[model samples]
Target: MLPADGSGPTLAIRAVAAADLAALLDSLPPAAATFARASGFEAAAGSHLVVPEASGGIGSVLFGLGKGSDAASPFLIGKLSTLLPAGDYRFESGVADETLAALAWALGAYRFRRYKRGGEGGDGPVARLKLGPTVDRARLESQIAAITGVRDLVNTPANDLGPAELAAAAAEMAGSAGASFRVLAGDDLAAGFPLIQAVGQGSDRAPRLIDLVWGDPDHPKVTLVGKGVCFDTGGLDIKPDTNMLLMKKDMGGAANVLGLARMIVDARLPVRLRVLIPAVENAISGRAFRPSDVFPSRKGLTVEIGNTDAEGRLVLADALALADEEAPDLIVDMATLTGAARVALGPDVPPFYTDDDGFAAELAAASAAVHDPLWRLPLWMPYAPMLESKIADTNNIGSGGFAGSIIAALFLKKFVERARTWVHLDIYAWNPSPKPGRPDGGEAQGIRALFAAIEKRYAGA
Candidate 1:
């Protein structure tokens, strides 16, 4: 883990003022001034003016990030990662939202070095900044750790982060937090979690279920289920080469659940926490579960595999069933389960489903407050008929691809009826492009909103 130390220099960050432009220029040395002029110094979102000593050594730096147009919109300092030299630096002007800037700085400092030939350039000094007096140290640290976890997990390849490795990662966190960790594999998984066993049996690495419990048993129970397909070859319905290129990030939902678990346990939210991950690799092999094959689930429902590519929901069904059996106060599952969701919401945002109005309202409020983006889609009871199977309780995929994400949610909803509240997030955990605090690749989409919702629900109870 990188040292996420919140230490830096005192930077004079303020919104750009026209009156101060002349003084700003006058304070610059000749070379920096020329560089600034050449680089459009006075431009918003661009930096200017390096104060220099008589010996020509660089002193303090000045930069711009524009005035705030919307209160919620991040006045991001992430661009500095690309524009500045390797030496230490900080924002001199713009919105002085120190926590936001600090987060941006940390994100800007991120580099995905998993597959690269050489390691990160030798111990380069981090561009540091003294967070403004208004900084919330604890909050900043929590968010950094959560986001870093997502990045690190997503950046690693499937070869390195398969089912066993993912379980080990969860166990590491559980041990640190005194959470009880239980993993069921091989014959136990085959007998107890058939759907999970069916999907993962094709791979040399055995399939398993990762169950983690923490907090007091007397507290309200909250269960989280994440689809842990370490790699998705789309099974018998194999994906094209281009589609499989980034399949390593297919376990993003599992990564997200772990990230949210960290936030919940570290904050000690007043609820009993349980996390269920059906960890597996949907690899192509002679014994891979085939299309039209029916398998019994933990809930005792038999599901006919309409498409092997739709394996995520099968594994999730078993896990959700287990979650529901506990009759928890709340059960929420996250998965990169459907292309329809990505087609509907695009890459950055995830669409959530829930039947509980109160839960929906809380999630919406959290989504707005934390800027962890999510949109609520209706359960749309009318679509439930599409999953009906003649020989079994249900079909994994619908007759047509229309409303695919909705149908998948409906299928999982079938396995989870005992919980007081249930919600499902259909997430595309990869960022198609880089942005302020979010870099491209495996990103955690909804943990912020979920964390906020859980905190408010359990706070002071």
Candidate 2:
């Protein structure tokens, strides 16, 4: 469904019988013990197993969904490709949560086929899973499309997904919603948004601010700013080779922002939605902005580049400043800004920065309920000094290596004073390994959490 890689097990599925198994053959019926044995495998409720002929061997597999675990176990079905024998298969029992099941099956079917185009992931033969009756075909298609869009965006190389391409992608989304969209690029970027221009100046591709607006002007304003360093070569301050490998996902914040936007617009949320992306390429070149360079931001705050690698906050500062100018009811910025964030909280859990206690609590609760998962790290005003700059208003990098994530949040906090409520998320957005509904690569981390929170907040209104 979601991670549709066209790979999965092909098997005949049915409820197991007591006589079907090796040991419980005489003692029990097929349905009772089969579920308990593979309980660890997580079968959905209403799922069943296949009992092959006594002589031909147990040729088919079983499926029984356990309790609904939200969307957490979608990837569990991926194991079907590995576990099933090399043969074509079909489904017997239909599941109520068919969308999730299809998504799980697709995710379980994925293999990164980049290096060896024709190579098999393992010695395991290709298995295909056929659909059963209890599925919503229309809804299944839509969810699959949304999830696959995220995967494709994440899978593309940085070179192919640079600033220009990122803008084009955003424009495409805007068009889908019939929203108004425009971009300030090149010299225009400097004329209106100085900070955006400064960070993007170092790269060959002109940096730009992408703005997309939709819904009634009278509606509550909700603004989203995403850091889109399509490719972060660490600018003048380059990262080591190992660090650069996954840098392709540096734009993960942008990707996830768009993913969240897609969900909002698709659901026809009543708020006035504005999506802002400061797209740039952090590359080492003669034109790249260097450390210690003081640049003027859209809000007219002068920022000194303490480290070229700290460019994400710079671009976000300019965009967030613009979002603040609107004084939106809610402003949120997502970024893969700091390795320190990952180190402090680890990749699985993202830390949110916000001064609003109620908003923070809601986000935490929503994240947990949806199984999207997030953690709240303090804004910690005491660490604000780490961003002090002798020449400019502030420095992008922290003076101390410790508390780096908190410092980065504080730096962004300086530019966002207008919104009634604001939240900043520093997310890994990538799953290092496979989880149930989540795959190993690019993930839509806090989107669902934010979606749930927003939905709950506005449900009565």
Candidate 3:
């Protein structure tokens, strides 16, 4: 997987905190010191430099980390993937947090090259990292593969990643893992998952409920449901150009679920895994389900469409209802459900709602441990009435402008009655700007923390 030219010299990487810059420079060889001085290498926070060797070749890269970024944050060293020369490199000494750093390196090296010609471009030759003995190769490789899977799926354009294609991707992943996969589409979708069909009927392609099951039947059941609205044109409630720009990423929740499933299956977690995705496109058409339309859901709730733009919850409700029926040990549902969540937590952090304090604690601890930050928002029972519909059982959206994210979670909570533990994540899966490890496009938010929490819960059993 090394992407550099083999003929170039290898370099050692040294991470220096701001306070240790002087000592770091003093400890280097005289030649290295001279190169640093000549090159104007100031070891400021988030800065870096390349020192030269006595043999008149490249030496090492010194990275300034401010206070050392914790092991969970793999992004601190992420910039080096493209910043360094086109050669293999390694850490100067044994790194206590080798696995995270290695994982960061792999993640930073990602380039979505499907449409971009010449592949991921670099200023110089593309750099490669030579794996050290301390690095956990298996863990690093698996994470990179899974995260890349998420990025690629979310990155693909709506034309390429429509509901049918998204289902194919899930089936492909399931087949690779030797898991059983099934799809309910067209007549089955209409008869069994009417909400999924209603939301997707606007599109030329048919809607589908994609399901994949893995692990032993006797294992603890852990189900995942994702909203796969491939391109949300806001249905009859059409969105403005600015709002519709990144709608291709509306299916990020589904992509992330698949990514997490990949991690669980690869690690052979004890839990029986079931992934349900309501793959659809909230497109505009003559047959598009409109506002004020009330539809019977898979859970038997009559849902009134307060606004057609609120279709993500409709599809997810059906999938969540199906998952809930299994009464899984844990039911986790993720979606690009609301703009209010982005307003509350921003894109970097997502707010998840769950009544179970123990599950919340585990998730919070895992999030903190992995630097995949998440916040808990309550399902405030008082605001539950906001989803009340005059005609139907409940409206898909709250009438008031307040507590939008909470209201969305509340609307979903109604459909899920049997699952012992249900956690709903209202995720804004798009990253508005570029940062280390995470690029300025589709992001897999909270999946790592979710995986960490799930692993902790079922590690031995």
Report lDDT (CA) for all predictions.
0.81, 0.75, 0.86
Query: What lDDT would candidate 3 get against the real structure?
Result: 0.86
- In model 2, where do residues sit more than 4 Å from their true spots? 1-60, 63-78, 81-102, 110-143
- Displacement of the residue 17 alpha carbon in candidate 1, Å: 8.3
**For each candidate, how many residue pairs have backbone atoms clashing (under 3 Å)?**
5, 30, 0
Top model number, TM-score = 3
- How well does each candidate superpose onto the true structure, as a TM-score? 0.90, 0.82, 0.95
Q: Which pairs of residues clash in candidate 1, taking residues 3 or more apart in a chain or in different chains?
A: 8-129, 8-130, 9-130, 14-93, 14-94
- If ranked by lDDT, best first, what sequence of candidates would result? 3, 1, 2
Q: State the lDDT of candidate 2 residue by residue for 362-416, as single tens digits.
A: 9999887655679999999988888889999888888968898899899999999
lDDT of model 3, residue 362:
96
The best candidate by lDDT is 3
Quick one: ranking by TM-score, best first? 3, 1, 2
Per-residue lDDT of candidate 3, residues 187-306 (tens digit): 888999999999999889889999999999999999999999999999899999999999999999999999999999988899899999999999898989999999999999999998
Better of 1 and 3 by TM-score: 3
Name the lDDT value of residue 207 in candidate 2: 88
lDDT of 1 by residue, 74-183 (tens): 52555555544445454555554666667777776677875666775624565455555577767777877887798789779988999999999999989988999999
